[model samples]
Target: MRFRNLLLSAATCAAISLSASADLTGKVTFSGKAPEPKQIDMSGVKECADKHPDPVFEQTLVVGEKGELANVVVSIKAEDSPDLKGEPSKDPAVLDQKGCMYEPHVLAMCVGQPLVVKNDDEFLHNVHSLAQENPNFNFGQPNKDDGKTVDQAPKTKEYIRIKCDVHPWMSAYIAVFENPYFAVTGEDGTYAIKGLPDGDYTVQFWHEKLASTPVEAKVTIKDGKGELNHEFKAEGAMAPDTSDVKLASMTKTSEKSCCEMSKKVEKVATATPAAKPADAQVKAAN
Candidate 1:
């Protein structure tokens, strides 16, 4: 009887050890000024003219905090999260290129899952896979019908890239992972990954800018729930456009409809010698 009791105690201790392991948790907040908005060349973007109407740029709707924090991919490489999701989804993540932009700019998919790239616009696009861990790929496709869907998949690319030949402005990148334990921060700058094994792990924060070396930290979780607070403070992670990155000018411009805005500004300047007052300009810049 004593031996039997000892074995049961050992089993319980093993279970406790697994559950008692530390769980890392935290949040990532942007602590720097947003990059300046870039000036998109309206003449270049509107090549098709009548076929595609000029898009209107809505700063508030298109960008968040001048894109300082939104769409940042934060993940935990715990290899354990993959065990939680029932086999990978059969349906591929469909990314479409329409009107010189990639729909769903941010995408996350598990390893081995198929990814479909479709050119919904009236021009050709290239799926340029910029992957260091996986294989590299770059291929072009002609635009099909508006409803046509392309059966495109990249087997290897730690992270993939897709660009358009007809529209240099069109671009998209896929954050591919072997496991499904990942998330992209929303406009509010909050992220959560459920189904973690209730333990401690390193959480990685990555951003297009202000994020270098994958700001990492040990997060402690409580009661099967973990909250991580992290700050990505890299000063020049994205690196200022020292080499004329096409956007060396304005900065974080989006392609909705800024050309029309330029027209308004030009018109106002022409009509009135006194442009917006310096104080008003300062207020507007803010």
Candidate 2:
């Protein structure tokens, strides 16, 4: 009986040790010369221009003096780790629109997590999502402090681009993952993904302007800790095209509703006769 009891106690201890979790910390840096940020022209919107007393440059690529890269997303690829399934957090991730720009230009969240969007600017701003995998949403926030909660989370892993139809210059990216092991680098270029179980993981580093594809690295977590450091080449980095004139042609305002345009199109189609085939017309003429 004494031997059996000792065996049971040993098994319990081993199980506890195997179930322990750890943290993954890392820093992302830039190796080459960073690109110059373009100055945003907000002179058309008086309210937006008044908010920024000084010139505001685009945040396509932000690098520190020490070559620390900011706004890079660090995540554990779901395809590589089958056993690292993590529950989504109950708290919602907040994205705020202030001074005609989205705060935290890059956001990473787990699947089934809620997203709260807040508009702090006094003027009208449209929240539009250009998601191919998930359902797209486009709504207008006319008043200040207009907060909307997007309760439905993405079912698949994807990088979604969010933009403001009213303000063509305003844009942001939301990265959705299957698990919670993802972190965004801050202005200091540091990121820490906590509560990860002990195992080997394939980590991916992604920056919007640096490369079209994500950089991958292998990391092993043991004894409650793991570290990874990566550097991205800043030379030849390209910014996303956000031409106001091109985007304006694709957007429709509330003044010209979709139903109204459809009715006009129907009337025009009814008035115009269909053209006969070229062969039939030639036979008739002969």
Candidate 3:
């Protein structure tokens, strides 16, 4: 009985030790004065305008109270760290549109993982993705509480920009990675990428405004968790263009009709030929 109890205690200790090695935590900070927030003119759509009684601002550069920067994608560039292997999560990554604004302005997900795009507003929203390496799509969700799960897995590491046709101001960025070792900085400018095996890695910090040049650092995780911090300046970073990204003017009555028509078309495209369910399951299981 004593020997069995000792074995059980050893197993419990091993489980605790394994859990400790799975975490990677860090913070991203800003070095320069944050750019003045850009004003978003929602006057084009009355419903969207009314939803925001307060003046809405563009999230071009979201710097926290401290020098912390939010929405930065901290990832282990797969090519640079070939030995690092991360399994994608079973649950799908979400990109929600609420109040005519995309919540979590920046998103990072593993390549081939399910991306669930949702619209939570009462008005029409068009989810148009501009991706070079992956299949590009432009579709609308006409009603409230509508969602579309897209399996348009990217063939390479890329950044896909999502825009709304009905609302010209709405835009978001999705950073697709080959591996699952990535995290987007939160409000406090902090990020955590858990479940990484102990090894040397090349960690890349990417932000929408600084896509042309990403900051890279070498980190060695000896005991499971590796801490990293990066600082970006506002001066060198390029802000996103606010001009019309091929948006055509529409009459109020025709807008709803247009959205509904596109929504139906997209539903057919994504529904019938169901994406590789078996592949996604196998990848997640690994």
Which candidate comes out best when scored by lDDT? Answer: 2
Find the 10 residues in a row with the least total lDDT in model 1: 277-286
Q: Supply candidate 2's per-residue lDDT for 167.
A: 87
Instruction: Tell me the TM-score of each prediction against the true structure.
Output: 0.62, 0.75, 0.75
User: Whole-model lDDT for model 2 versus the true structure?
Assistant: 0.65
Q: Write the per-residue lDDT of candidate 1 for residues 1-286, one digit (tens) a residue.
A: 3432332233210112333332232344544554454543446545433335544331211234633355556666444233333234555666766555666676766656666767666666675654545555566766653433333444432444445556555555566654445676776666655444544454555544433223443443445555654443334334453222332222221222111111111111221111211100100000
Candidate order by decreasing TM-score: 2, 3, 1
Misplaced by over 4 Å in model 2 are 1-20, 236-286
The clash count of every prediction, one per candidate, is 26, 0, 0
Best by TM-score: 2
Q: Model 2, 166-189: lDDT tens per residue?
A: 988898878787777788999898
Candidate 3 matches the true fold with a TM-score of: 0.75
Model 3 gets an lDDT of 0.62
Judged by lDDT relative to the true structure, which candidate is superior, 1 or 2? 2
Against the reference, the lDDT scores of all candidates come to 0.45, 0.65, 0.62
